[model samples]
Structure formats: structure tokens, C-alpha cells
Target: MSPFSLPSKPLHLALLGLLLFLLPFAILRERSYVTIDDNLDTEISIPYLLTRYHVALDYRPTAVVPPVMNGLPRNAMRSGLSVTVAVFALLEPLPAYLVHQALVRVLALLGMYALLRAHFLKRDNDKALAAGLALAWAVLPVYSMYGMSVLGQPWLLLAFLNLRQGRSRWTDWALIAGFPLWSFFVFVGPFVLVALAGLLLWDWQQGRGISKRVLLGMALLTILYLVVEYPLLYSLLIAKQFVPHRVEFDLGKLGPQTLAAQLKSAFLYFVTGHYHASRFFRGAAVLAVGAAFLLTPAAKRRAVLRQVLPLLVALAVVALFCGFAQQITDSLQRVIPPLRTFNLSRFHFLTPLLWFVVLVLSLRWLTSRKLQAAFIALQLLIGLGMNAEWLNNLRELAGRPLPDEPNYQAYVAPSLFADIQRYTMENAGPPALYRVACLGFPPSVAQLNSFYTLDSYQNNYPLAYKHEFRPLIAGELAKNAALRTYFDDWGNRCYLFSAELGRNFRVSARQHQQVQDWAFDAAAFQRLGGRYVLSAVQLQAPARSGLQLRGVFSARTAYWRVYLYEVVPSSSPKPGAAVGQKLPEISKFGLLVCKNG
Candidate 1:
């Protein structure tokens, strides 16, 4: 059959295309809204990639990227969104997340259709069954919310579809390897390996030996990836070197309670109604499909089981993976703190999908053709209603509020970021030179500067950064620069090297960590390459020190009086002999000091 002929019916084809076209706008009625992670990663990664390719703003001058951070520029530093943004770089700025989700959903629906159609054709079953199963899975009431990147649900189904076809291509293998990079695959790869083995076993039983071409094709692709990324792979993996103070990894949502909750959540996540509201009746209906299979005759049961056994094995493998991932035992949770949520069930993406088509087939017991047609229509309606609910929920979430760091009424959007961005652009030298540092917070708001900053926040940090700034990581470096005090808050780590700060205004301790307050040793700040310090609080210059009072950005009218101070490099002192005097403990001023400054 020609690839175009897979839909088999004109109405099926039209609805599929129409749904794909509408999903982005429907689900993303949130406008250009973004989650903290989505806004942070996409804003940084898209520009980062485009800049490296010389297409967007340049970040190389002050990017401070570690070796691990540079693994694949075209990978665009996103999960599934990487493939989308790379393919359509032009769409990176506008609605990229929305567009990426739309594409993933489309692939999932179409892939389902193809996989089931192929199986049905071989067994001489009705192709409409394939269409109905594909439609049911497409709207199954679970998504990652941040972006489709974390939702491997669709991608897993698509991978199985590809496996069913048993065809090998270089591009296909390349994509399969990179599809879930850096996040879900970090811990989910083991179970997928088991599923792949199951596929191979089924094919062998069917008289098709392993395709050696796939083995060689994948081997060649592996060699190509390794050769292309030898420098990065060698530095990060072999030498254990990494970009210093850039990315960091902190254990998220740990402990037995978290694991237990996650297990319960995964089970509930599967049978949430079409509207994603609890419908235990529908869930029970799903289980009843299995009982129907049990009631089949000796001959029909055997034939169906042959096709379904592989899926069962695949499902079992993933179920075991999901269970292990939750660290079910108290001792295990102490060490592994699974990343998937009790609420979202993100890691169990493929579990529900594996045997869903079996249920769809079992529903075909209505003797009259009219009754069966009505049943199909009802399933499609349920899927659509669920999709409608999902869209409305997204709208509600977006309309509520963008989260402020803490519950300070000072708006996170339109104010905190807007004020910071305005002050930095007006003062931070030029686009190509100079970096801005937030004296208190770790550039969370400053990141919206959308270009370069001396601020950093990431989940994986290099060992070198830890070693060089041991005091900061250990939360020890106190005095003269309380910068270490600000490196962390709620387990997220943010670091930026002072060397990456800028070339001008030399100082001691090439970097400074965040501090308890904006007041760092003013004289020490100058030596540390801080040209402009945006203080969350107002401060008088370390009276009599080299610190000069610059314009106060967004003064008394705002929630806090944000003060901007210029670091005055001490004039080469006249032979008077007062080198670096203790410029009074301006506690009333900005009471603080910089690291070793």
C-alpha cells in the first residue's frame, strides 16, 4: 500500500489532518505564555543554537557553557522540542512550544493508525478498527503541561509503530537514539531496551531473522555521532570535565512518600475519563475488554493471542520499569527519587498505550452494522470531548497568573522581569560586551535579559566549578563576599564565573556567588569585575569607597526600591599610603562583601 493510502477512508484522512491543524491553537490558547522551564530553556537554547550558527544573537563571548552543555548545538538543548526547533528554526521565537506539541500529537495519531492498519491487513481484520484505536489513544487525557517534550507517551507509541514496519533507515535510527535525550531517557532507557528485545523475539518467531542492515546502519550512525562529538564526549565522559558553574543536578521530590504517591498516581492516570475527570466506570469498562478476550473460542483466542502477546510482553516490561522507577522500597527511594510525578505519571507514558487496541477490538461485539457504527462515533466523540477539556484546562492555567519566585505580589511577569531587563539593556555596556549580575538572586529574573548575563541557573554543574568554588557549593564561603549564600534556594543551583563577567576591572576571586543581601564589600565588588550591580534594595555608596551612585531603576513607586550602583575602580592612590582602607561596615548601606575581594 502506498503511504498516502494508509488512512483508507477520505473522512478519516480529513479528520486527521483537520485535528492536526487545529490542536496547536486549541491547546495553546495560552498565547505566547510559557512555563518557567519552557521560557528559560527555549529562550536560552533557541538563541544559543541560532547564535552558534550565526543566525541569531551571539552568546559565545559570554555563554560560559560547560562541556556537557555543548553536546549538540542542533540538539537545541530541548527534549522532543529539540528536533522540532532545529527543523523549524524560524518558529523558535514564536509559539515554538505550541507548535512542537502539535507536531508530536499528529505523529502519535498517524503512527497509531499505521501500526494497527498493518497488523489488521496481515490478519484480514477491518481497517476501521485501526482508525478507531488510533483515535482513542490520541486524546488519552495526559500531557506534560510544560511542553510535549517530557511526554514520551506519543513518541513511545510511534517507536512501536516503526518497529512493527521492520524497516531500517539512517535517519530513523538517528532520531530514535536522540528522541528522548537528557530527560526521560536519563532513567527510562533500560525498559525500552527490553521492549526492543521483545520486538526482535516476535519477528524471529514469525520467520524473519534480525535485519543485519539495521545493526550495521545503527553502528555506522553511532560511529558518526561519536566522531562528530569526540571532543565533547571525551571531555565530559572520559576526562570527567564539564563547563564550570553552569548546569547543576539536584535530587527532586525524594523519599518514600513521593514514590508511593507516584505509584498510586500512575495507576489512576491510566483510566481517567475522556475529560480527564475520574470515571472509574470507564476504567472498569477498559478492564472488561480483557475479560472479553478470555471468553473467546479456542481458535480465535489463539490467533489473537499471537499478535497480542508481543504487546503484553512489551507492557509488562514497561510496567516493571515504572515500578522500579518509583523506588517502591524505602531504601531505594533514599537513593533514586524518581523524576516522574505521582500526579502526572510521565514516565509511564507507554504503559496504557501498549494494550489499548486489544480493548478496541474486543468492543466489536454488536451484531448489527448500525450499532457498531454508533459505537465508533461514540468513541470518537469521547476522544474529542476529552481533547476539548484539555484545551479549556490549559486556558484556565495560563489565565491565572505567572508564578512569582515567592508569593510576593510583585508580578513576576510585566514587572520584575520588565524592570530588570530595562535597567540591564540601558546600562550593561553593549550587546557584545559586559555582563550583568544580580547581587542577591541567581539571575532568575535576569535570565529574561534574553541575551548574556553573568548569572546562571542549571540542574547539572561541573566538578571543576565545585572544586574552584568549594565554599559556595558547600554553603561555606562567608564574609567579604556572601555570594555563596545566594547560589541556592529550594535546591536549584545557579552559578556564573567572574571571569565570564568581563575583561575590564580586574579583581580578586574571579567569581562571586549570590549573597544574603545586595550589599557586598563595595570596594571588593569593583575588583571582582562587577561594573554595574542591580541591588534588590536601595543602598548608599560604601561612603568614601570607590562605589558611585548610578541612576536608581524603577524607584519608590515599585514594591522595592531597586538601586543601581557602578563599581568605581579605585583610582591609583596618590603616594598617600592608604591602600584599601576598611570603608566602614555600611550595614545601613549595602552590608556585605565579595569573595576574597
Candidate 2:
């Protein structure tokens, strides 16, 4: 039946599903702050993005403009926030993270409303049901209590929403999809582009006429994307010096067993909330939906199977195309000529795009009341489990024993991050800038740097491959001297690329000093930009753990040249230098405590 004619039960299911999806975020609103990852995007990157092109600043030459948190690039992705920040800058530096989260929530709700209303909400009962479901989903307590990016997801959702509505040919789809992708190099840009191409190809293969209007629409897509990214794009091309090349991944040589393992990990990734804290419930809910589809009555099933088959085939195609570990590795290597600095991770936004389609199909399957109820029950169970999981996570954050990754503190925010940020910025004098490398650990802190790097974790996910960088990608990145400079290890101001370090940076005062001592000066620390002096004390050890040298003693510190190298060798013969001078060995003992005055 047409979406408009969906029965009461089916409509209820749609709304209920949406609410269920939203429930975690809504219920945990108080706890809702930007996760460290999101912060890296909106909070940290906003200032840098503004300064790069919009505002008059020294604009340090870096690998790319619109700097990123961690390894993720945030250069061209701040279009949505440019105006917001500009307004905030007028008042004061309002926390862009909060703004980002709020905006994302609104976008998510709107997208969900539009999706359900378009697909299921027909009569009064359906509307009520849809509202309930959407709310429940939106605020499900099972997801992380505080995080951002829900809004970002909806931009991609809108693109799919357009496609679902048979308006896939609309130029607006490309523009809408590209907007988010361009803004957050981590989420959906390249994936949306891939999805766009797929839709366009499908239409073309179906013999749909490519009208001048359509071609112009396509041109509009390009124009709009470039417009949004005009500033950053200009920097990369003119100032950054773009290069293009390819990088290779020997995935084919990874033997069948390793390949299978990677595939299983990827599959389990979506099937379970293995990595994502919010969508854990989605796994069981999707399974229940799958079961419901399988159990349909023969006649109804046959009718539905027509739709189901294409969807399943479509899913398989997308999954095969987007799935696998090496896909991302390759995507990062493939560069589009001048856009060498582009990241493949930006295509990850497509995961939500594909999932949106899957969710709609599941909701459509709820045309039957029994199935809808079963699915709802599954959702509720998942939600409950998710809540428990998060609570456990929080408890672990509070110094309780954790079952896994005992480093829960690594991902969670600490009180010190803000203080550290204040100190770093306030103290960093002219030409002395703060450059942080954000990995996906906190997922939110990477947006703080002048330029971010590619999160190695993202090297494994989907849509990650579509932008596969070849020599084309690398050569392009090489051309951008600014982008190259960001990667230079010239400063003491480097942030470790992980969530653990981010949270710890804020929580552990000593660690913060170790960081500062390694990178900045004591005077800079005291006067820290009129902000609090956030210092860390670091005790470095061989990254290779459990190695005990019988004769040699090792001292690990950022001041390697002075502390370790300058020390008189205690009757130890200096080893001959190879192609590279090897770091001196000092770890003879099992453990040693060395303190700095």
C-alpha cells in the first residue's frame, strides 16, 4: 500500500520507531553534552575555521584550512557553523559544541518527522503513534547520555529522504547531501557522493532522460558544494598547494582467514553496537525487523517480497562496495586531482544513509500489527540493554572496574579539557599555535586543531573506501605544503591521537603538565592565555611493554636529546649508527621511577 494508506498499526510502528530511536538522547538530555569526538568537530574547530578564511588572522600555513581534531580534517566542513560562530564571536565564544548538539537534535527530529510523516503518518492515529515512536527513539536512554552529531546524521538523512521520496533526481539531494559531507569530513561527504552517483546511475540505466535541467541540477550540486567550501577550497588550491596521488592496500593478499575476520568485524559492527554507544539498540531492533520480514504470511510475503528483494540486493551491493577494512585504506589513497588533502572518512556519513533506508524498509514491514509490536518489543529490549551498558560505562568512568578497555576515562571528558584549552590558547603567543592531533578516541576533541589528521580507526569503516586515495590522493596532499606542515613534528604542542589522552588531559593535572613541559614553557604555562595553567606530567616508557634490559637503563621523556642522550654512558659501548641513528636503550631494569623537579 502507498505510505499514505498505511494502516493504524503500521503508522503507529513508524512513529514509535522514530521515538524509540530518539529516546536515549532525549532522556539523557541533562547528561547530553558534546562527546569529545563531536567537540573536536564543532567546539574546537569553529574558532580555527573562522580564523582561517573568514577572520583576519596570521592563518598559519598548514596541511589544510579549516583545521581538524585528531587526524580528521575539519577544514572545509565548517560552512554550517561559520555564521553561527560569527554570531557567537560577536557576543563571546559561545560553546559551539552545545550549539552543534542543539542544532543536530533539531535536524534529527525534523528529518525523522519528515521520514515518518512521508512514509507512515496518514490518519490521526498514525500521527499520534509516529510522534510517540519518534520521541521514544530520539530520547532512548540507552545511547550515550551526552553526545552530538545527531543533527549531522539528519543532513545525510535528508538526502536519502529525498531519494526515498522518488525525488532522487532533484539537484537538491546532491546539495543537501554534500552540505554535511563538506562540513564534517568525518561523516558523509564522499559516501553521499557515492550514493548520489548510484542513484544517478540507476536513473540513467533506467533510460531516464538527462535533461538540461538535470545536467544543470548536477552542475548546481557541484556549484553549491564548492560554494560551501569555497574558502577552504581556495586555500588548498591557491595557498595549500594541492597534489594528487594513490595509496595502496594489499587487502587482496590478506589471506582468506584475515579477510573473513575483517568482514565479520564489519558485519558485527552494524549488527551490534560494537563501537557506537548510541545505536546499540539498533542491532536487536534490526534483527527483530528482519525476523518479522521473514515470518510474513505467504500471500502478504510475496507482495512484500517484491520490495524486499530489491532492498536486500541493494543492501548487499552497498555493503560489498562500502564494507571491508581495506576499502577505507584505498579510499584515502585515491585523490580527485586537485583535492589531494580530502579524507575518505568523510564518506562515513553514508552509514546513516544506508541505515535510514534499512529502517524505513523495516518500518514499512510493520504494515502488520503483530510484527510491529514484536519489533517494538525488540527495540525496548535493546534500549534497556543500552541504558545498562551506558550506566556501566559511566560507572567505569567514575573509577569503577570496567569489563573491557579499562581505559574508560580515555573516551569520557574530564574537567581539565576546557581549562587546558584556555591555557593553551591564552598562552600561545603570536606564531605559537596549538596543534592537537585528534584520533577517534573521544570522537569530539579533534575539531580543536588548526589541522586534523585521518583517524586511523576510520581506516576500517565504510564509505571510507569510495574516496580511496591512490597516488592521486597522496600526490595531491603533498602539493599542499600547509597541509604537510601540520604533520611536521616541529613543535612541543602535539596532542596524542586518542580519546584516552583527551579525557586524561583534562582529568590528570600531572599528565597535562608532562604534556606542557614536553611542548611549552613554564612561563607560557603560568600566563596561559589568561586562562588556567593546565599542565601534565608525563612518565614515558618504551611503547613496547614488558621488555627488561639487563644492563641498560632507560629514561623516557619528551626531552630525549637532553635526558637520555646527553647522559654519560656508564661503560656502555655506543652502537654504530645504521641508516637511522637508533634511539639509545635505557630499559635494563623492570621499572624505575625518575622525577622532575
Candidate 3:
């Protein structure tokens, strides 16, 4: 048997290809530069914290993760029922991450292969094409922390299509039931349900009756989501524990303002896609799909349009909505209460699957095997080129590491934080005794090191806490307009903002950046139980800022030079205002009382 023969053992070939594609991430391990944007800085910490604190299954209304934002609600983190959370629970952070990534990619490969083989490309000779496309789809640079939300769409669609045709069995039902446990509802669920509804409507419009199985599948999927994401649903609907900062989310201020900018954003979203949902240059796919549609014979052109046009239109509509969402949301918020806080712009999540489906359809028209192979190769190249993980590995392999981008080991700096933690314990007390805030870096770093942080980067938290925390950064915000807008309009990242540093979080030791005119509120910092300020950069005029430098610490492999600054004591300190003293009863603002407080 030929080693590369598709018909004899297609699954083996696909698995081998996937293994090769993921080998760099596996081999590099902690040295690999994974995505840092919404990934390392935010999502990676959630699973780790959830498992570390043994709160993955904790459902108490007041359950909190003390390491984050003083005491962030446990529900505010990712769902405890998530497969990724379970993986984190079973293994260490890096190994668990690798295992989770491998699992997600394997699922993507199998799901796409099964979907294409069963529905899209069923001919005996089409196995190679299906396998190739499946492999390409699997290798797209998707955030694996999200599990199957983006990459699992093909499998999901396959299930739905089977139900619609009355060919679904136990396995299809299992897919529908199991999807919610692994995937996030807020990110992709609602949009997918809406798409399914649209599909049902289209079928009904075409004189086809409603498929009860499809309806059952939808209900099952929703029920599973509600069950898995019970904590999130409870926090939002039932408990209403706290008014989230999302309530004040000003889309108009946050997104593109003018028509031209909106159009440009829409065009970019259509062609390049969004970073959260598999971003890659789509010029090849777009051109091929367009050419195929145009070059089709008149007799079969209508049939082809029927297959491809809706997907094309859906992609355009999603892109335009994402671009103009701020305006649309602002106009609609007055009438639609849910639209005020809930982001309707996430409809673009559907575009990734839509674009790939269009690719599959377009490729079906090409009779020449060489032409199909060429287009597939071009797409694979584009996907890899855009993948940060892959590109960073290539750079590492070529001995060219980007100074700004640090690998997992350097970014996390476990040893450095361990040293700092030990020093803090010896000088002050246990980390649990006092809250610390971060400067020039995300609080997630401190949180990962088991530090109880006063500040954090959370998608949702109490609005009252936001107000309470604002005074600390008020001096800096007053000086900087952009910082003020970022906090006041969309205060997800309730960090100690500095006008001097702006929004650059990853300030390396090599930069030697210093806050010269430090406009920090030390009194407010003391009030919030902030015993120490862990800064990546030095505050040149520490006395002016009412801060006394305690120590300077660095690790050989760490990227940061942490300057530990203790809040200067007031001449007449208030009762319970001393360092390590318990904070006041501010936690009762929205039934979110901090356990440590």
C-alpha cells in the first residue's frame, strides 16, 4: 500500500498531517510564543485559577476567586463544566494547555473530515479532497481555550444536516448534547441557534416542512448549554448579584465612529476575519469562490448560486454588522434592553465556518485535481502565515525571537514571582493578608503567582467595584484622555492606569521605562488594602507619588524588573487602615461580599 494513499487509510494520513502541524508547539513547550492578546493575558489564567483554587465545581452564590480583583466571583470565570477546565484540573498549566490544544485540533480534523465525507464530498474519488480540506480547517490559528466553538462548526452543521434529512442517529444526537459541554455559549451558541432558526425558516419558505429532529436538536443543545453554564446564567438572570461593568459598555465610544472607518473595518473583517475566530488572509478562497460562481455554465449556474449565494450574503451581512455594530447597537439599545449589555456583534463568529463552506463549494466545481491542490496549498500557506503560534515557532527555529513578544516561561516567570512571593511573605505577611495591584502589566501575572490582586482584567465584574477602584487611577485618568475613555466607557480592565505608560502592559526590563511625573493616589491605594504596588517599570519620583520603594527584584529568564513599592503611611492613619488590616464593608454593594475582606 502506498503511504500517502487516501482511500486505503485517509484517517491515518490526516492524523499524521495534524501531528506534524502541531509538532512545533509540542516540542517548544514553555518556550513557544502562544497568543498573548486575549489568550495568555486573560483566558489562560481562568482555567488555571479555577483548577488551582478547587473552585471549578463550586456553585455557591458568594463563591469567589480571591487571587483576582480582590475577590472576583467564581461564575465570572469560565464554566466549571467545561472540558478545558477539566483538562486544567487534571494536569499542570503548560501540559494541560498542550493536551487541550491537541484535543481540540484532533476534534477539528475528525469533525471536518466526517462532515465533508458524509455531506459535502461523498464521491469515492473525493476522499482526498475532503481529507485535505479537513486538515486545512483543523490547522487554522484558532484559540483552543475556546474548545470547539469556532472549529467544531463543521461537525455541528453535519449533525443538523442529518437531522434535517431525517438520517440522524444516536451519534448525531450525542454531538448536539456534547457540544455545549466543550464550547462556550456566550461566544458562539446564541449566534449558532439564530443561524439554525434561519435555516429552518429557509426550509419552510421552500415548501419543506419543519424538521422536528432539528428542533429537538436545538432544544437539546440549549438545555445542555444552560446546564453547563448554570453559574453564568444564575449570575445574569436569577441572582443578579451585581450590576456588571458591561452595563456601561458604550459601543459608540469603543468602536469605529465614522462611516468610512466602519466600511474599512467591515472590509477587513470580510477578507481577513477576526482574531478571536480564526483570522487569516482569505483572498485566495474569495477569489476562487467568486471565479467558480462566475465561470459556471448557465444551466448549472442557478443550482450553484443556490448553494453558494446564501453563504456569501451571510458573510457580507455578518461583516457589515460587525463593522456598523456600534451604531446599530446604540440606536437599538433604547428599545432592546438586552442589546444594551449583550454584544450583538458577535455574529461574526459564524463567518469562519461560512467562509470555509464557500471554499468547499467552490473547490467542488474545479475538475482539475492539480488546480484544486494548488488552491488548497495556497490556503494552507495563508493560514500558517497568519498563525502567531506557527510564525513564532518558525522565528524561534530561525533564531529570531521578537523582543516584545515573550514565550510562556519568560511571560509567566514562575520562578521570578516565587522569589517575589517569598520576599513579600518575609517582609509583609502571607499573600492572603493584603491585596496588591499591578503596574505596566496585567494582574493575571500576579494572580497566577497566587497573589491576591486589587486590580484585574475581567470581562464582567461589579460596577460598584469599578467606581470604588476609579479613585486610585483618577489622577492619571485626569491627565490622559485616552485612558479616561478606555476606563469610563469600557472598564473591563480595571487596572492602575498610568498616563505616562498609557496602555503598554508588557514593559520589559530592557526598556527601563520610568514614570517620571507619577500622579498616583497613595491614600486611595491604602484605603483599598493595596499593601504593595508591583510595577514592571520604576517610578523615578517615588516620594512625589507617595510611594516608598521596598525592593527591586529580577530573574535571569524573566522579562520584567519588578519594583515593589509600599504605600506611604498617612501621618494620622485611620482605624483598620494599617498595612495587612482588613478592608471595610464595601463588598456588600451587590451581594458580592469578599471572603477575605
Best candidate, lDDT-wise? 3
lDDT of 3 by residue, 36-64 (tens): 88888888889999889989999887787
The C-alpha TM-scores of every prediction are 0.58, 0.55, 0.95
* Residue pairs in collision within model 3: none
Root mean square deviation (Cα) for candidate 3: 3.0
Candidate 2 lDDT, 1-597, residue by residue in tens = 122243355445544554444444344443332333333323444454455444422233332232222112223234433344444444322243334334444444445555566554544545544544444344443212122233344444444445544565444455453453324333334454565667667667778743344444445545666665555555445553222111223232331236677676455445443233244534644564466467766667776656545555665444443345344444444443322223332233344334444554566556665555555455545554655434543454354633332221232323334333444445433212322222112223323322222222222111211132112123323544432232221111123222123333333221233221122221221111111111122324311211111121112211111111111122222355210122111110100111010
The Cα local distance difference test for each model comes to 0.40, 0.37, 0.84
| Models sorted by lDDT, best on top | 3, 1, 2
What RMSD does model 1 have? Answer: 10.7
lDDT of 1 at 469: 29
> Ten residues in a row with the worst lDDT in model 1?
587-596
lDDT of predicted model 1: 0.40
Clash numbers, per candidate: 21, 108, 0
Q: Kindly list the per-residue Cα lDDT of model 1 for residues 278-387, writing each as its tens digit.
A: 12223423443554456566567766556555555544444444444434433343564332212222335435444455455555432344444455555555555655
